[model samples]
Target: MTTFTALTTLDGKAPAEALGAAMEGLDPAPTGVGVFEMEDGSGLWEVGGYFDAAPDEVALALLAAAHGARPFAVSQLPEVDWVAHVKRELAPVEAGRFFVHGSHDADKLPEGRVGLLIEAAMAFGTGHHGTTLGCLRAFDRLLGAGIAPRNVADIGCGTAVLAMAAARCLPDAQIIASDIDPVAIEVAEANLAANAMAGAVTCVTAAGFEADPLARRAPFDLVFANILKGPLIDLAPAVADHTAPGGHVILSGLLTHQAEEVGAAYARCGFNPVASDEIVDWTTLVLTKSG
Candidate 1:
């Protein structure tokens, strides 16, 4: 069966959330609703709803008007087996000694290399993205340089691929994977279990390094943050606070042009850039904290 989506944008988080909440009460209520702040540096928040059936345009218009949002744009979406498509489309991604693959490509996992089983159902960090790949390669390079970190943290770890890599290579190290979205944490746990590394990496639902699980494990020797440019800049100070002197941070999810700014932010927090690699439009940076 086909589905329909209604989307609108409004200023302010409150109005967008209120509009999303209002959408839930409509007749033929939405199967899912999302209210997100657009990351384009545009001050707009997008409110969207998915319905199994066509939504009432009048109702949507009224809701938008009441919320001071633009008129809802509704569209029909074709029903497709997204999981199957992803499995077929995403082959194995190799970054140095790490291989990220779905179960469909399990046989392609090479010998003597660490294999991370990320299923197609998991929507984030399949390692196909340049940012994720860059982070993995950066870590691999560090390992080659004989940088062995005993305490590590993976902030905004969507699928926990980076954390898992650290866990596999540094079996004796303590690794924690964290994400603000609880759903991503669930995905991380699933991925960990799939890799038979369930207990190797602790999974937490927290923003940046705020929660007790992360705070108690402070002064990390290494940290991985594959999040967007804005959050990476905002997180520079907190990352510096939790990192030990001479600790390393592998940061990605930045456009090539944004890397310099992020590097400058970290520099102000006593971090010196060690390496900056650009893969496609994304840039991954490796920086070490100065004593």
Candidate 2:
């Protein structure tokens, strides 16, 4: 297994400066930064980047830079062998009436459960992340309520997990799943097919609701966006415009503290908060459009 080291430094350098310096020795550098408040309420930032060096060397450099402040750490990530990892991680499982697994589990699905096998490369939404699980729980709640949505859209669909969940729940429903990343769209297609849901869900690559051709169909009974706060705030209008009268929207992936800002954005877009829940430090919201 190839190992890559991640070095986190804190010498009072600005985030950009620290990131720039960290990038010097790293190859195929970090894609983004993840910032969250520590348990003690102190802000913590994790700069994720890739490196081909020894983990100890990376750790020593980052730790030495801190000079005993203990604000730096290094961790190693196994270089992902996409095919092998995907196969193992997506192994089959039976959860009540729902059979859940990844594409690699195609031949192992247990009988007597509705099987949903997906193959999500690295595009998110394999039901592993907390946010994705939260959204799935929320979707399950809606399903339990016996609400049959005529149309559904999974915005920023990622690996199209939510969209697939919806399709599983509302088999007769019209559903569209979209993402800004073309790679994500490709993954979603594979995932849908692996689950034998290719015909039930349409996957597309789009910037947001505004840029999506399906948005013109308008007024979907259910819409979901599990993305970052910035994009969520910016896409409020498009979310509102595409949701049908008396429809509902589920938003996740925002910090609990950012809920107010996100709520206000949706309010401006004509959505009223129906419910809000928090898990860990993340917030999930359910909003409804007035009839």
Number of the predicted model whose lDDT against the real structure is largest? 1
Q: Give lDDT tens digits, candidate 1, residues 1-291.
A: 889999999999888999999999999999999998775556689999999999999999999999899999999998899999898899899999999999998998899888999999995799999999999999999999999999999999999999999999998999999999999999999999999988999999999998998999999999999998878999999999999999999999888888898999999999999999999888999999999
**What are the per-residue Cα lDDT tens digits for candidate 2 across 36-133?**
22322234434444445544455445534544233335567756677676666554534334556665566676665556665545435666555676
Query: Best candidate, TM-score-wise?
Result: 1
Locate the minimum summed-lDDT window of 10 residues in model 1.
36-45
Clashes of 2: 2
Question: Each candidate: what lDDT?
Answer: 0.94, 0.70
Clashes, model 1: 0
List clashing residue pairs in candidate 2. Answer: 30-49, 219-244
- Show the lowest summed lDDT stretch of 10 residues, model 2: 33-42
Candidate 2: what lDDT?
Answer: 0.70
